[model samples]
Each structure stands twice: as C-alpha cells, then as structure tokens.
Target: MKKILSFFSYVFHPMFISVYAVLLYFFLTDRYHSYQELFLIMIQIIILTILIPISMFYFLMTLGKANSLMLSEITQRKIPLAINAFLLYILITQSIREEVIPELYFFFFGALASTIITFLLIFVNLKASIHMIGISSITIFIIGFSLHTQVNHIYLVATFLLLTGIVATSRLSMKAHDGKELIAGFLVGVLPQIGLLSFWL
Candidate 1:
C-alpha cells in the first residue's frame, strides 16, 4: 500500500502537472494546424515545465540546496519555487506574444500566479502541500474549460476529483501534511484559476 501510494505521488508530481494539463487541453481541443505544430508545442511545454525543472531539482539536491525531490522542507522550496515563477512568467508571456493558443493563456497564468503566491507564503512559515496544489490547479482548469466551451466534461471532472482524493490521502498517509494544510493548498491552487476564469469567458 505504501509503495502504491508513493508511485502515484511520483507519477503525478507537482512538477509535471502543468505540462500534463497543457497536453490534455491541446489534445482535447480543436487543432487547425498541422500535427507537427501541435507536437512542437507539446515538446516545448514538456521541456519548459517538466524536463528542465526536474533536472534543476536534481541538481539542487546534488548541491545540498534542496532536501529532496519532494521538496518536503519549507526552506528547500524557496529557490525552486522562485525559479518556477521566473520560468512560468517567460513561457506564458512568450505564448501570449506569439498568439499561440491565446485562449489557454489563463491556465498557464493561473499556474504561474499560484506558484508566486506559494513562494510568497513560504515567508509566513506555511508549508502547504504542493501535491494538492498541483492536482487542484488542473482540476479547476478542466472545470473552467468545460464552462468556456459549454460542454459537459463530467467524467474529466470526476476523474480529477478522485485523483484529488487520492493525492490528499497519499500526502496524509506519508505524514507530509495535516488536513488544514491540505485544504489551504487546494484553495491556493484553485482560487487563482477561478479568479482568472472571467478573462476566458
């Protein structure tokens, strides 16, 4: 049971959530461009959000700057979160400037905003669960997408809800966070995206 929970935590690590959400959004939405263009976008997001950050985390670990890949320590989160805020700022600005998937810019922006808020919250000595933040962010994005398109993605919504529960359970089972931290993480992850929903509509 412990191993299974750990596997899910690793597979759905916070670092990979944004890319996964972007990938799903691209595939699920219409594409007027060629397959190559779509592939290129996916590659860009994967590298920017996943590959680079993962490599950076590993390097930070090697340098004793980060305690673990999980970022279980509050102090360890500062540099990585700061780097993520910077990178996400660049990616979203570039995407908007290029007018590529302009409609989806809010999702990326919401993620960036959430990261910034999370980074700032570290100063107050709060260590909310990043796992919950990642899952909830994606969940809110999917919900927003459904509302924007006037389509019922009930299944997708339900799937993420289940995933949210799983993530919360795993975090608790690992003794990484208390219920209060979990709730705060979910709110911090979701509220930014919800606030940006009006721009999309």
Candidate 2:
C-alpha cells in the first residue's frame, strides 16, 4: 500500500504534471497522434527530468539542515525557504515540449504529491519509507483502476494522504520528532507546493 501510494505520488507530482499537461495539449491540437511520438517524448522527459530535481531536492535538504528544520531552528521558523525555488523550477520546466506525457497538469499533481511524500519521509528513515511508499503506490493504483476513479487523481492522492498520516504518526510514536520539528517538516514539504499551484493565480 505504501509503495503504491508513493508511485502514484511520484508519477503525478507537480513536476510530472507539466510534462503530462504538455502531452495533453499536443493531443488536443494534433488530433491524430501516434504511439511512436508518445514513446520518444516520454524517453526525453524520464532521462532529463531526474537531473534537475535531484540537485534541487539536495539543495533543499541541505538548506533544511542548515535552517534547523532538521535539528536546529525549531523555534526560529527558519525552514530553508529553498523549496519555493524548487517549485518555481517545476512550474516552469516540467511542461517542456517534445513532451511525452503531454498533459502537464496531471504530471504536476503527481510529482507534487510524490515530492510531498518524499519530504515527509525525510524525518523518518528515507530508505525504508521510500520502499513502502513506492510499493503501496502501485498497489493503490491497481485498486483505484479497479474502482474506476481515473478522471481525478483522487485515488492516488487519497492514498498519499493516508500513508503520509501513518508515516507521520509512526515518527511521532517513535519519538523521533518533537511537535515543533514535526511542524517544520510539514511546512518544508507543503508550503512551497501550495505556493506553486498557479492555476488559482
């Protein structure tokens, strides 16, 4: 369940949304697209997409450390504002053309949700949580498919939220996170993503 949730979250995060949205736009305009065109585009995104976010995620993590979002600034409210910059990068770039997934908004929510799950797990043991989230993501996806909830990303998002709750609770029960630190972690993960949902703007 955890793994499936993570997969859908990763697959549908904001960055991925840009890629998928572009693909959708292309299909709407082209009206007669082919499978080969689709494959080539996804290949382009999959390879290059990882490069940008890896660096950005690291930078944010380091900033998180320095700001004490991890172990330092619990009271100061200095949660490494770099995540905002990362989201800005996603909003702008994830939708680049030659796009395979083409429907960028879908990609946006997927990547955004996935990223959220990743950040939350950071407070715990990332290696273990990631494996759980990823596997759970796929399982839930199948369940969602079976249930016929494809129009909205609701199934995956719901799974993501529930699993995140579990992980957060686990951390709390383990005494790995104090109240302030837990809030900081959530702020670090969520605030910036909420900031980047430019559709409202």
Candidate 3:
C-alpha cells in the first residue's frame, strides 16, 4: 500500500546512502580486518554524512529554512544540498589527506560529484529525485568496484539495481518525483561514478 511505499522510501533515504555505500565497499573488499578499524571508520563516516546532516536538518527546520525533513520543495533543497556537497567534499579530502582507505577515494569522489551535480541542477529549476541518485550512486560504484578488482559481483550488482527500481517506484508512489526527475536523478548518480572510475582505474 501507499504506507508501505512511504516506509520503504523513508528507510532508504538519500541522507543515509553515503554511509551505506562506504560500508558496502569496506565489506565487499574485505578491508575491515579488525573490529576496531571498522568501528573507527564507521563512526567517522556516520558522523560526517549521517549525524551531522541530521542535526543540520533539525536546525534548518527550526530556522524555517527547511519546511520538511524530506525537503520536498525545490526552494528548500538548495541550501541543504549545498551543505551536503560541501561535507562530502571534506570527507573525501580528509580521507585522502589522512591516507585512509585509499581504495575508496574514487568512490567518495564519485559521491561528491553526484552531490555537486544535484545541487547545480537545483539552479536550473530541476528538482531531481535524491532518492534515485542515492541508490544509483551505490549501484554504479559496485559495478566499478567489481571491474577494478577483477572479481565477479554480478549478484551484488543485480541486487543493488533491483533496489534502485524499488526506490524509484517508492519515490513515484509517494508523489515525490515525476518520471523525468527520476531519470535525471539516476543519470546524475551514475555518470559521475563512471567517469571517476575510468580515471582511477
């Protein structure tokens, strides 16, 4: 039902996608050799991409800058997207500077690229579906990771792709986006990751 669809949409929110992507990368690559390391990395990523953003959203809502947690209005999206893009950039740069998780540099860069494009498109009067963008970014990153590692992750890739469809449907069912916005979101999420993967690979 509509409630179920709304639940799914909330469950797979774009704000959490960045953290999910990095966690997926770590597990897929078997880079989490120890609990301590994994804990540290997860804490860092969650704080940067998830916790801070949540707090900011609450703050924005208090200030009347954002009308909803969803930021469903086009005008409400610009500042939040800009802030997220900036935070993502900082996350990527700091990871590089610290020489931590070098394998994921391109992945984070792709995420940053996606965020940048999404923010820019807001200026063009396009309110692309961030939901679609979030899912697409991870799906594309998984594909690129499989290729770079010369490992077959077709099942995982397919699973993420399937999730993409579910996410798209959820967004549509919730009346969060039209077809054009959905398509734009998917492309914005995918293309940058592909471009970055090619350069890094």
lDDT: which candidate is best? 1
What is the TM-score of candidate 1? 0.93
lDDT (CA) for every model shown?
0.83, 0.43, 0.82
Top TM-score hit: 1
Ranking by lDDT: 1, 3, 2
> On residues 1-201, what C-alpha lDDT tens digit does candidate 3 reach at each position?
888778878888987886787678777884446777777777878888889888999999999998777889999988888888888788877743326665567777877888888888988999888888888988988888788778899999999998999989999998889999999999998888888877655
Residue 201, candidate 2: alpha-carbon lDDT: 19
**Residue 147 in model 1: lDDT:** 82
**Residue-pair clashes, model 2:** 45
Which is better, 1 or 3, measured by lDDT? Answer: 1
Q: Write the per-residue lDDT of candidate 2 for residues 91-162, one digit (tens) a residue.
A: 536543224332333334434465455554455643123223333333333333333323455654576567
Each candidate structure's TM-score, on Cα atoms with residue i matched to residue i, is: 0.93, 0.35, 0.92
Error of 1 at 98 (Å): 8.0
Alpha-carbon shift of residue 132 in model 3 (angstroms): 0.8
Please list the residue runs of candidate 3 whose C-alpha ends up more than 4 Å from where it truly belongs after superposition: 30-32, 96-99
Model 2 residue runs over 4 Å out of place are: 1-45, 48-91, 94-154, 170-178, 192-201
- Give one digit per residue, the lDDT tens place, for model 1 in 34-127: 7787677778788788888889999998999987788888889999999888888888887433266755688888888888888888999888
